[model samples]
Target: MTTPDKPGLRERKKQRTRTAISDAAIDLFLDRGFAHVSVAEIAHAAEVSKRTLFAYFPTKEDLVVHRMADHEQEAARVVRARPAHTTPLTALRDYFLDGLRRRDPITGLNDHPAVRSLTELIYGTPALIDRMQRFKAGGERALAEALCDTTEASDLTARLAAVQIIGVQWALSADNFQRLVQGETADGRYEGAVRDAEHAFDLLANGLAALT
Candidate 1:
């Protein structure tokens, strides 16, 4: 598996370019707000042409919310690749816990100043919020399909499980992000956040296992 820590040369180059663009976009958005910054300005700041920027990011909302895209369909991927003896929810729980340990930004436990700024930018902007919700809806659908494929669950059962699991996770992450954006540090909240995550998954797994 081509994990991020061991990216190929071409992947590394692409990552550098992507990082440059995202860093420039984030600086502009944090300084001027997501709604106030234009795609052209971001492209210029990143030293990329507007067409090239569009090539990487289809829309202005994407420039700001692309960070969310990094793990948009991760649940589905995790469910599909789980060990044979592991339940989907168990795999997801372990995956989330690992992310929390790494302070991964996707887990809402990362303490980077830029992450907090980006969180503020997304929630405060109506367009960005809409885009993010769409991304999450897509994740739910993908996970539902994966659940059905892996467990031979009926469509309705799979969707119900997906909604319950994803909803709890999204809520927990939102709460964590809100706290961080409102002047809390990750270290101060890490223990409580992990506890909350475990509880959320426990609730979700109970409900998931009971699904007919």
Candidate 2:
């Protein structure tokens, strides 16, 4: 058996730089809202040159939303990796339920101060909101492509299904975030969150057929 190689020194250094830049940007954004913070300020805080910052993140919005980059392909990966005989909807539904259990920020069930603050910032700023919508669309497209690969469905059918699934997940996450922001504890809201997820997935699994 071959051991997987670790990231080389160059890769590790680049990752450290990226993390520093991202951390600096988030700190500035949280302290002075997303709209008020400048990319130059973040670059200064991270001790990186403006050119280096631009090379790492093309747009100012990317500085803040880059944390979501890991999750961009998550749905598609789940679809591609599900166990044999498991339907895509079941795989995704179970994945989300597990995320809620772990209080994953993507599920919007995390009430940590940092997570809540970032969520509020993104929801409050128009520019960040627009950027987030683009992220969501990319996620949907990836899931659609995965669906087309794993099933015999037409491209249109796969895309429509992806849209509905991704939309439902977003709506659920938003509702969960709103509850937390309203001062509800994540643990206190756990039961209700689970119920809502189940109900939403159930609708996706069964109710949509009635529309045909």
TM-score of model 2 relative to the true fold? 0.94
Which tens-of-lDDT digit does each residue in 1-212 have in candidate 1? Answer: 86555558778888788889988998988888877888889989999999888888888888767776758899999999999888889999999888878888877777787677677778788998899889889999999999989886899999988888888878888888877877788888889889999999888867677532
For residues 1-212, write the lDDT of model 2, one tens digit per residue.
Answer: 97765669668889899999999999998988887888889999999999999999999999888998988889999999999988888899999999999999999999998999999989999999999999999999999999999988788888889899999999999999999988999999899999999999998988444322
Candidate 2 regions with alpha-carbon error over 4 angstroms: 1-7, 207-212
Candidate 1 worst ten-residue window by lDDT: 1-10
The collision pairs in model 2 are: none
Scanning candidate 2 in windows of ten residues, the lowest lDDT window is 203-212
Q: Kindly state the number of residue pairs that clash in model 1.
A: 0
